[model samples]
Target: MSENNHAYTLSDGTSILDLPKVSLHDHLDGGLRPATIIELGSEIGLELPASDADALGAWFAEKSNSGSLVEYLKTFDLTTAVMQTSAGLERVAREFVQDLGADGVVYGEIRWAPEQHLGSGLSLDQTVEAVQSGIEQGIADVRAAGRPIRVGQLVTAMRHNDRGLEIAELAVRHRDNGVVGFDIAGPEAGFLPSKHRAAFDYLATEFFPATVHAGEADGLDSIRSALLDGRALRLGHGVRIAEDIVIERQDDENTYVTLGTLAQWVKDREIALETSPTSNLQTGAIAAWGDELIDHPFDLLYQLGFRVTVNTDNRLMSGTTLTRELSILADAFAYDRTDLEVFQLNAAASAFLPLEEREELADIISAGFEGS
Candidate 1:
């Protein structure tokens, strides 16, 4: 409501946070409250960069803006460190949903690698249960507060590790519980999705959905592998798909463009691009395009008919929310509420939920935008 507390407002004096949104590629370990991290870190006797919340938040932002994906990922080490136990995982997951609900997110997919949370002697199943319990509690909390929100876990496997097959199975095992999809995160350039072909193959056989982290730290080839090898239903930060598009000619009246085979396939298939504006800028994912948000190819991809969805990949690290990400895009591209609503609908359509459920989410979003 108030600008002091909310991250964004439109020119019409509308709080962007009041709009219903869908988050397709949000990270669980990356959205913890600073205070929660401090408390959890203390309980585990873990050393933190800053003992206080504000300072710790600043530390995360600073590290994330280092313009290196690898360095940006280092910030997660601290967050995941505190989330090594059931209590820690539950609290983090609970707060994650509460924060999403507060941000006006009607539905969100919280992605985190379970392989990274085993430091406290917890099995993969136990970790999944802990997070699911937190998610249920968080949903109840939001409903009690007169807000309706839905969330699903995108159980992730670190790409650099060899536990992809294991993590994939864990996700499928919990499909009926809270896990809705699977994802592969970590270094993207060298570790192609093909490296986890076995896992993707298994997921394919089981008819499970997956979204691969691609075209952020790498290029078209990586994306190619993600589609062919990972069988990804969506591309996490697939902004770099722009690289495959060539502007053949530009004049005052028109800009002629051509899409490469890879780009053509992606656009034709309507694979969603989980582009996080702030996080992309912070990690230099859009560096090839340009330095500032205005230079991001998100608009190009959007205009070119890509199923682009807005996201806060790492809310805490980027110091952003879904509202803030949309506001930034609106500011840079002069988008209206209709444009914002389309992004939400895109996310809803691309969600790993069943067709009827996705349609329901789309209806909810369309209704909200109409009322607004």
Candidate 2:
């Protein structure tokens, strides 16, 4: 489906695209506009797979759909290539927020590694500042257009790199400016959260919040490390936690299951699972179960009482949005508007905002759904 198309809907025919939403796992580098990529590539003398916006977008979808993590990641080399300078970062960040607003996202956390943007001699702090300035401009532009939207930064460190502590400190340093949280991205299999012990320890000492990318490409052990070592307040696309679940039986009336300790902890603690349906399929995050969306453990996790929040891990790569993700899940699981609202509430509660602010967001979501 085209990125502009709505992939799911409410029972009463309400467009899922019109519903208020919260995007928790969106990546700043993973969501560049195709036209913007072409323009930025022209400015930087970078080669693109396709010169036209639609064809370039289709190229991203094809690469991401290859079911190879390496192939999926190769697409980002092109995106980050155009995002080295301050102007590039600011423009991309601004467009990211504007796109999220256009897709009915009321609040979002845009995560990206500053280290990746320093190829042009910009400091890590300068990169963060540029992105934040762009985010502010995007917010102003959205407000001027009579749309209400809010965005925060989740400064990310490369899990495969040795600068976790430095990045964690950078995130904390800008907590009041625009950064709201810390995260670790990149290869997730061998580079466990325990590898970044000193960084997590420093973040703990500073009482800073973190959300680790675990249980996506990796399994239960990585999730355990995220909680025990990283002290993660949330799990980024922790969809693989379903590996810990054992399904006993299923009938028309009921499905019986058992949960392992790790799954139980995630359920009891309500650590938000940033489940991205299309991205999960593309990255093989849900390959243990099946290839289709219905085969995804998202419904199983939700039924098992995990705090499941729908997300679009990479909008451009997956050819998706928060609205499209929700729509696809609803279509797969036969979910109604109430189920969709529950997912939004789950995300709002798990957001890194103050409790009162989260409550306000919940109120907005509730009102929006009610009006719909």
Candidate 3:
């Protein structure tokens, strides 16, 4: 069961929440518990649109489902406001891990932009330390509860901002700490990864990894820049890449398809697509395909071997858990345990970990699924 008790049992009565999973594209600030937000906001004398946790959660969900990426982002103003202090940031991070653990995530990468949390007096490094402290405490809490879990930070740089180089340096500086990788997130259409060339170059020189937000709020041109300019190893919410694929003809037995040049490169390289299904529908990322999850190109990408990984980009805003994400996909596609296991394995392969560790994670997942 998830933290919300969203029990998703498979056909064989195997609970999805009991399966060891890997989360590669969750956001730290986006996963805050609604009760925590109310408490933190009260402590900071912040005005919340909703006075109660349930109401606040519903409010976020309602706002995020507005079918516009711009409107979907307005809810973050409140979340970021409450996280301006070190204590708030640490507490949020700790609870975020607890929630992930409860949802059966063996490993997760929590991404957030340090620049957004600096509204208070803390410096850049201070924010990183605060989040790391919370992650350690959360890991301890999960272990104390007898569930093994591991988590790392992916420091993000808002694409609309000019702090890409500075945030990149901050991420590299804290690589030995809890920070594991780098990313650029935020309104994706107007702000191409090319604008952050200097930062990408710096990270490349340092041999650091990155996952850029593309193919969600933007098109193939944006994805091209993410690969060539940002040098991203993975793409965040890369559902739009389906736009580049052309189905020449479909018959009862075979569906002939042709991949565009850029799509072919991404597929050939096995670059992971960090796809968030519900969020994609809400943000209209897959409107070009259809308005429903069944219409999503996830199955198309998976059947064609695109290294697609499932993720919950924003839990609170979407009112979802990783468990729920998998459950919905399972329900939509009539997926069996084998299909679910494949998604988890794909995520394990794409995690920001060493080759040996990723293999170890894969072994854990395989073992867990077998027992399930």
Candidate 4:
């Protein structure tokens, strides 16, 4: 019913790569090509864990499966190391857009912390410019190849660091450029979003949008901080929000459910959950539920009418594309093309674009799916 020979396909024989998709939580530093890393690492005299591109890719995939968020995040050091220079950042950004296009992404928001890439003496603004330049080039590349694709930047601040307010200002300053949103990414357990309340408040005043990383390495209280203090429009890897739901009982054909106040608020507001299955499994975000993809609360949330969007949090580390993510979820949850279309529609609506643009995206997705 399905094939994975060269391209990903669904049970109905629809090529997943031909479907229009929108990505919400993709990380810029975490999606680099393995060959690019080797070349860039060589320029800076950095020793790689593997010599060849395929093995280096395997190395990243192997290292990221450690089942600890902290341990899984250590892989970013190698990626960020090569992304310090302007040229390096530009090239990576350019290629990232191309890769997403190839994976059938019509629109995507690439998030990264500029602070982490400042080691090469590039100012925060310079890093943003370099990335924007590459994104534009990549857009052109995709268009030239007869594919429609667009990407925006989500400038992120390190939650464990002290430059939250500064990073927020940088994100707002470039709002007209490639930047579309702001975020706080890093260890999520102790570094609550409230630690950057001032930054969130500034963003609130300027009316800049933000999506906080919460409910992944932390629990309900952290998600609460992200909503109450950070005013996050979306929750990054918010699979743990499932903890707030209490399944009272399940009959032969129906299951009774009770949602806590936090879960109710998220559902009512339609705040998106950027759920990355492989990344969640690797980071132990869904460990309490189960270790496999089926154990992910993704189905529970989606079935409960929560706004859940599939994402590739880190393509390289997870060794996954968006098509692969959707395909695996389909296999695990027995979802058909309609279900897949809904997921893409949810993502299109949740994108940081304006209402009209989001509607346009939804139209595009609907048309693509209808055609398929």
Candidate 5:
């Protein structure tokens, strides 16, 4: 679909930015404010490509949209470079939550690899605790400001690294504090979840939830490993699972399709697909299907009854918010308030929260949609 200048508004003029939303796959390190990055970089004696915040923001956007994952990841190196200390981590995490609250996210799961943040001699446990402290502070600040926001930590293990088990243990240790689940992120092509099978097995044995970054930079095999080996409850940017679906016929109102075994399992089991529209387009995650947002398999997966949820995988890198993502999707797919509510319901159902809290979130979403 053609990009619309006024993409994020409802036909009747409802502002998408005002809608209560849930973010499932956002990265803590990838959502830092440009000004924060500059200040933190300066504090650490690190020279940035751009001395100014706006210029640095533009630089991040440019590198991310360059159609290369390697280049896109290089931007993270800068962000993480400033996040090695407790103060840096705490401030960034707090700001991340505040930004999410401002973006109308009622709840968000912030994922980051603790191992990557240990360059400052902080232990893994210390890093997780620091982030949790920041998250708690952010929540208190949001509540103090009369806004209701809840955030959870999705402790991540870099798939290429050998500390998966250590990270998994760390996530489990903090489960009662702020950690809600475990995840494996990083280069998704060669670093299969199977490589971290020991960690996944350990998490499974402990009954901890896990999500895997699959089907983005990789294909169905990677997704298969995530589900089978990683026991992923959700697929991080699982946009490529569409590759397994065979579209047989299409009419103006209906499309007939056949699903492969993997797609069938993911759909029938209600596995959540965390689809980030702008990030997917920028990273070429949906390139095989098409280049535009409208070409994304999100609609296809949703139509087939897969638990598809909208997300901002990396807000800073993508230069987007969840509101903008949903707005663009609404414009591209002709979605309405009902459609948006359904997405929220799907996300609420798939949240790592307890059943009662998930129900509460669903109720909140229903009430909000009805009021709108």
Candidate 6:
């Protein structure tokens, strides 16, 4: 888990890590290599909780595993501490893409709040440019190794902050550069997407895509706000949308259920639910149903035809990869190769890329799954 690249397998003896995948919910600050964090901490003269790489990574896991929201979020303070300067941001971004490439990700959208990185006086544009440069370098590095990766930035605005309009503008400004779409991360309970209606309105006018972090820390109301106010094309860990579904009864013949208006909208509209299995458990996002992977509503959503996509919300904190996430789900639900391929295809379709590129991604995924 300390190393971002980890091999996974299915019961059928297929190499999960070798399959082409798409990542739409990964965080740039959450996927840093422990070694990189240690080195960057030293350069910035920032005091770290742990001096060694292993210990530092362990510290992150420990904090994130505490199940307390406040404690879980404190881990980011350390990761973002060293990511203030341009060089640090660029380096971390470079390594992030490289790690994703190693994990067999053909396309990924890394999300991070540029507003948080302004502590070191780097302008918002500079931070975006630095990360884009790193991503390009990482792509080149992967190509040099005879593999190719395509990555884009999901410029994020902290939902709890009032910088939504500014960040939204920044994302639109960099639309042609490397920024592919926009997102709203951070605390989601009290800070609903409606709080940033103006920003979403502007994005709608500009016809930009967005994916809001809803139904993770909050419930149906938050998801409603995401669709109605944020105009989210996808739901960032929209796992809690399951809350709106009422199971009337279950039997050998049938399992009866009813979907609330909100749930029906999300499901029928095919809004992608970026469900992160491990992160959901660690963050208490799935505590309502149960405390294990088997209890996740991912299978239910997929069976019900929601555009369910597998993702690693925070790789370092959750100690997982896209490969590992798929494997975990496969084991929990007894999913087969076709099931895993459906998840990949769902992600490819949900990607914020142009329709043609998304179709290209779908073709790549279909071919890979078929070849396997």
Candidate 5 lDDT by residue in tens digits, 1-372:
112224478887887877788899899999999999889988889989999888888888888997666667878999999999999999999999988887778888999999999899999989998998999999888888887889999999999889999889999999998999999988888899999999999999999999999999999999999999999999998989999999999999999999999999999999999999999999889989888998899998888899999998898899888888898889899999889988988999999999999999988888777776
Which model scores highest in lDDT? 4
Q: What range of 10 consecutive residues in model 5 has the weakest lDDT sum?
A: 1-10
Clashing pairs in 5: none
Report lDDT (CA) for all predictions. 0.92, 0.92, 0.92, 0.94, 0.90, 0.90
Q: TM-score for each prediction?
A: 0.98, 0.98, 0.98, 0.98, 0.97, 0.98
Please give the lDDT score at residue 313 for candidate 1. Answer: 97
What is the alpha-carbon lDDT for the whole of candidate 2?
0.92
User: Which run of 10 residues does model 6 get worst, by summed lDDT?
Assistant: 1-10
Give the per-residue lDDT digits (tens) of candidate 3, residues 1-372: 124444678777888888888999999888998899899888878898888888888889989998899899888999999888899999999999998898899999999999999888999999999999999999999999998899999999999999999999999999999889999999998999999999999999999999999999999999999999999999998989999999999999887899999999999998999999999999999999899999999999999999999999999989898888999998998888999999999999889999999999999999999997
Give the per-residue lDDT digits (tens) of candidate 1, residues 216-290. 999999999999999988999999999999999989977689999999999999999999999999989999879
Q: Which stretches of candidate 3 lie over 4 Å from their true place?
A: 1-6
Whole-model alpha-carbon lDDT for candidate 5: 0.90
Alpha-carbon deviation at 273 in model 5, angstroms: 0.1
lDDT of 2 at 111: 98
Off by over 4 Å in 4: 1-6
Q: For candidate 4, what's the RMSD?
A: 1.9
Error of 5 at 27 (Å): 0.1
